[model samples]
Target: MTDSESPSGRFRIAISAWEARMSLWIETPTVLDKTTGETLLSFKDGNWSLDAARWLSDSIVELTLRKYPGNHLPVNIIATLDCANRTARIGEKEVQFLAEVESALDNALTWRTVTPPPRAARSGFASAVRRFFFGK
Candidate 1:
């Protein structure tokens, strides 16, 4: 197992690997918030199959989340790599997904009590205009 921090130092990552069935099996890395000591994301009972063939060809890694803090985040994530092209894609909404993950982590660390938006505000602009015109 190896532990490291993201370049930004906002996240700590832990990874473990071993050999099995003639392949190198790597446990999906766990991600934690650096400041709060909270697990933002984790995976278990799953591993990446790294064989010589996979290294030379296309490959896919499926990850199952052991700890996911947000409703918006996925319990399962799929990452595909085009080894020939040296390109990769993980999940559908890459940017939005990362934003949601960070938001979930930030929410977990927030100390203040958050109040929901007022009902009128939640109803949307058209409803607010109607309420103003009808005095309802």
Candidate 2:
């Protein structure tokens, strides 16, 4: 996954909240890996901050398994940002979504552009199936 900068003139870090159908909120205090006693994230006030940015990245990734709780997880969720035009995306969906969000943000703020690595497109159904089973 690509690491991103904080939105224009804003803190180099930002916080966002993601939730599933049950409405359970994801935070640092939440269990990351129950079997391993790992916590998904650790926010001081159910929030994200610049100081916790790196930690949040790890935390959010850890959260995916629990939040999905199964192999075939239909990733349906919402991302709420503290700042307008900030970028966020869920799972592998982040590539295109980030581009869209970041483009809008850059236009709004007139920030200089930075191109992210191109997303890989599966060449065929067999490759797609392999990736699905092995998480390439």
Candidate 3:
């Protein structure tokens, strides 16, 4: 793991197993909305990857839109995963906040609350029967 310090010295970023996967883990105190300077998210010494951050941001936006219907167009989350600085910014070109936008974000954070079905179940009955008979 190669560790790097941000210019602000607020957070540290590490790149682990880079040869196998180009994943960056960022240890930051909070993620903020660039325009509003509001704390959108906070972590308890949590290390999150850029991909995860992007997905989470997108999910929060989508959930916010569906849960509370309104005009929330062109609002996207941008992540800067540079070794020097690991940060996220909310880009709202056309912004309209939902009544329960915060609630939606909280709900989106519980993305893994529901467990997925097993591989066998996903392959269907025919695959299960074939595996049982063939001892695969």
Identify the candidate with maximal TM-score.
1
Model 2 C-alpha lDDT per residue in residues 6-112, reported as the tens digit of each score: 32322222234455347554432222233344322234333211212323432232122122222222322333232222235433344233325323222233223
- The TM-scores of all predictions, comma-separated, are 0.34, 0.19, 0.21
Those runs of model 2 whose alpha carbons end farther than 4 Å from true positions after fitting are: 13-68, 71-74, 83-136
Off by over 4 Å in 3: 1-30, 52-136
- Candidate 3 has a TM-score of 0.21
Q: Better model by lDDT, 1 or 2? A: 1
Order the candidates by TM-score, highest first — what do you get? 1, 3, 2
Tens digits of per-residue lDDT, candidate 3, 41-64, equal 443223322232322222231111
List, in order, the clash count of every candidate structure: 0, 3, 0
| Best-matching candidate per lDDT | 1
lDDT of 1 at 60: 24
lDDT rank, highest first? 1, 2, 3
